[model samples]
Target: MLFPVALLGVVLAAVAHEGHVHDATPDTVPETEFQSWVAKYGKQEDLPFSGPLSFSHLPYAKCLEEPDAKFSVAVLGMPFDTTTSYRPGARFGPFGIRAGSRRQRPGRGYVLHYGFNPYVSGKTILDCGDVPISPVHNGLALDQMEVAYADLLRRPIANEEIDRTRSLALDGVEHPRIVTLGGDHTIVLPILRALHGIYGPVTVIHFDAHLDTWPAPPGIPAPYEAAEITHGTFFTSAYKEGLLTNSSIHAGIRCKFTGMEDLEHDVEMGFALITTDDIDDVGVEGIIKKIRDRVGSGPVYLSLDIDVLDPAFAPATGTPEAGGYTTREVKRILRGLIGLNFVGFDIVEVAPAYDTNAETTATVAADIVHEFISMLLFEPKEKTAESDFRVQAGRNGDEL
Candidate 1:
């Protein structure tokens, strides 16, 4: 295949500069990296964006194919939405979210109000690119996703001085965390499985419009059967596999159930529900406290279903519901979660096919991810004593 000269030049520029040292005198012979870059590539507009598809256009964002290197966190894309019960194009969520995040590149300052920059917080962040999925087979797709996440978890965490006093590090070595751009809520099942393999059963902090803990559809001979792998039933599968703790809680729920028994069943599976209506009664602070109280000091996994926001604010999701929280409300709530023992996170159900000119849903998805990264860097408003939480780091110093 013949390549365009501009594209070829950009590719060659990237390939040629991997380990070359630049001379510093700009006027003399293009010594420094920027000068050498300009001399070699001609101009900024001449080269294509470097690095794998990444959020925030971070320079450190690297492809997973590179020899293993230390990174505090990695953003992995799970572009598999075959199991969605409603709309299907969430398969493009990672792409849409990445495009939306590019809008932040010029500023690269996501948390303006707090003045926190995750990229410069002594933590290396990588965009590990998207996991390949078997489009025709949902079961195989999920299996592939689980294996991908597992492989990522095995890599070394970037070397950083962890604040044992406020960091999520329960052991001496902090395992790199993953911030997953989800294909759909079903993606959580595989992610949870990989996380469970590393951290044991984690307490869940689920934010969604639906309970997602519905009993697996009938006629599946046994629990967690492949036929039962729809988005709505994965939590049940997670529960069956002992991947979650009774301390788990679901916020922003508004989906109607067949009967009260469904809620009872969810409780039995060890999850508490904080309906969207409860947000008004308890207030955001109260809701935050409830979440913290429920999750306590256990290792926690956060799953954010964009549909948890009212369709008015985020209509691009697959299963949007009315009467859900506003974008601002959700942001504040997530910001409140900063000091918890978060192990991993996902923002799912962003089907940009349904979005308006505003790119409302994709932008919101990016912002949610931004907050997750913020949580990784910001000190909790109040740091608890190191002895308060129970954290056992795995043998490799990269697993929890």
Candidate 2:
């Protein structure tokens, strides 16, 4: 009786196996609904640590790859620091800045002072990724940057609401504004070359601890053509190339100069100096007024070297000075220049290897970029006059 029971169990197991194999055939299974699966999993918000890394979690677009891709403003990275005078790791500045910006999501990007969210202000802003730069050759890398920037500058505007009347282009055609994350200060020379092709010579607002307009030092021998266009002397090259307007201004300058002759050369190259000590005497408001008065309503290209901040505030830079603006002072000055006609901007010299674990330098650089987006999207004052607290208080018969 035990043998007969074992045979019966084996026969039942064989039958079940045959049935399972038949049911598991490819044609017998239902196709998966990808749309349903995507609907369930794809719409979630990106946590700061989880998403594909981009500046402030903004959309990533290969603007260079897609010719039809349009944006009002773009965050472009130039990751070549071969021309750096001191630190070398600024080649990674773009990556450090994007990593530092992880906490700034588009949903929470509202500025209380400006009373609007730049991320959601109906303008298409994109992280266009980094320019492909050749590390082995400086000349090749610079030329590549120039070509890439010119292509991006010529792309069609995504926001149709932008006022073409305010454009500084001689043709009055609207062009996209670019906020570049720099390789080093040398990148600005190529950038100015690109901008000159469109708007002609633009007034530059340079924020740096150094004059940057230094000619090759007196002792540096002749026939050193390659040494002439370093990070320190890019502005000198720009002036020679006729890429700058004579009204350019330099703020936060306190770098040790060769002599009064350096100041005379800087002035000759088209820059009015505003020292770091000016903040103590004339105040932040005074600095802003001076910059505004100098640049006026002309097309302005703003360049900020990370060394403009004191080493205590932003130590992850190539060349740092003791007395420089704090992050707060820089932000206030940027806010005060909201209505200026800015065509381009850059934050340079962020060498993250020199930074602390807190990433203070990259973080502050990213926040300043947030201010750039706000300034670019800011509506004309006349349109927002109704929302002014002063006007609202008057209407309600309120007193301070």
Candidate 3:
């Protein structure tokens, strides 16, 4: 039995030999040249997706184990969900996100307004595959993830020349930015540790329904408290460790809290809260301004919990909140943050088992990441020719 033509294209692209990929100017080429290039280039073996399964059919490699290839944006999957408080299936979030992104292959849906296909943005992006973790040991799992992320972030940025002999140390080399497909909200804790090793404490823009800053009850000892290192307590732990700055803020917070102190404790931890109701009060523009004003000009880490979307829009997350932002609203808000100093990002808590036939949840997660990569590669004032004939509306800074 043959796979769907699209899936077959992805499989071939992944296992293809290196050095056969084309650097085409899709927007600038003549019609006859573009058609010839597509037909001939379709058979080339050296292309993106060098591994068996890559996100959005991009190149795939284990950067930590093999340093031969160079990359600028590395996508790593964290497939551990041991610490989830409400549901347990987010261990499969990475797979679901990757599967949903397959539709973006053959450059079909690259947003024209963004002015670039991330795959062809003259930057190297590789799917570094998923990190290995022991399900039985949360502490050990956390340690392994932190170590893996640190190794990836310390890698030197890829240049035109492929230098296989270069050391993978920070050693005055610029590091690649990372976009992680998360197992759960808890995964952000280890990611914070790894990023702090390089960029120091970062300002976080956390989008979630729950605060995730709830502290463990008092009177617990060391070993006992270790058990409290869960999804709900990660932000509190992060604040205590000084991995995040006072400029950190939470958006789409509508979860039930114990009382006024929960909000006060979060404020003391350096977070400004934006409830679901705020979406109506401030509108998307006002919300965008608030985010910019809060994050300022610091290295920013964006952690998006899928539950930030209303259950109507995304019902496949572990904790489905009823009142939350719609997918369109969230996308518009994210687009507004373009050009900010972003170091890393993650969209967590997608559990495909709970999804509808439309696969609404996983598709939204993939779309969010697509916009993220586009934002990462965005440049101001570069205009594509009118005869470029790309699909979709042209995006300007204020148009969206």
Candidate 4:
């Protein structure tokens, strides 16, 4: 069992370079009124984000507020997508997620059933933007994936980046929860390796339609390897490298269209899959409970492929399988993970180009991050819900 929670003791000076969108002070409200407002709202967003402002940590931009060291969660965006078989635009995922989140109305930004804003709770999170990637031709993109892998694998270990991620879990700073938004599932390999080194044997709760654990097809030519290294075979690499724990669960797999031989091969790999049929049988809440128990006590790492949602719910992803978890079902499952020793979480494969209305997946994706941030940041209070509701309703009064 991992320590209830731990943060690498290094002070997060890196994120100090990143900038924050909101600078509204707690003192904006008078003390008496502020206390009354807190009593009324518990902890909820005054408005759902619907604006046109956001911040990022990409090489193009500067830094943001780094808070007073201790934090609970950190978000990193790996925007290299040389591995997707079909759509190749996911390399821009980090920008889209951050842009979506920045547009969110800060402060209880995701105030659904529970008050949420993963970041605003004074949690130290760095939008450590895209990992520096090489500019390769799209046709040869998949072939050059090895370059990104090499960069990710050897990022000057024991360096400042490690110190930043390590300190996120420390007391008085942030909760040290990591939520990575991706270039492809392969991006998880390096991240998991780093995390496993920090906390051994972490659970990888993956939600995707395809069993991503296929062996890297040999030789970099077309035909068999035609799909570029692809989003198709990330897990295969991790599982083979012994980087991922065998106990990790692969949920939301609805892939029966492929040849039975491939299916049998995946089955032999010891992945306990929760197919669409299983999700239907157990109910999302029930399945969530099952996940909580299986990955119990230990530090858990979660990776959600937006395609986990049915194509109807998220048409903007690189790979859109027909039937999958409904939007509501996905929320139920994510919401249930509260209070667990979740080390970090990631949401990948969101390609806005595939969207008819950009809001389809981007909005949902943003809301998911917003909600997760809210859950991890807020200390559970007895009156949290009631207070959040009243305060939200009284925003005009509360803000005044």
lDDT of each: 0.79, 0.87, 0.80, 0.60
Q: Which runs of model 3 end up more than 4 angstroms from their true locations?
A: 1-51, 159-173, 218-221, 382-400
TM-score of each: 0.81, 0.86, 0.81, 0.67
Off by over 4 Å in 4: 1-72, 110-112, 115-117, 137-175, 218-229, 257-261, 267-270, 382-400
Per-residue lDDT of model 4, residues 186-256, tens digit only: 66766665655556556678889878877566676664443434467766656665666656777898875
Model 1 residue 242 distance off true place after TM-score fit, in angstroms: 0.9
- The lDDT ranking, best first, is 2, 3, 1, 4
Name the runs in model 1 displaced over 4 angstroms.
1-53, 60-62, 110-112, 161-172, 221-224, 380-400
lDDT tens digits by residue: candidate 1, 247-310: 9999999998899999999998899889999988999978988988889877889999999999
Q: Estimate, for each residue in 133-200, the C-alpha lDDT of model 3 and write its tens digit.
A: 88899989999999998888877677432211122223434567788998988999999999887777
Better of 1 and 3 by lDDT: 3
Total clashing pairs for each candidate: 5, 0, 5, 32
Q: What is the lDDT of residue 400 in candidate 3?
A: 45
Using lDDT, give the best candidate's number. 2
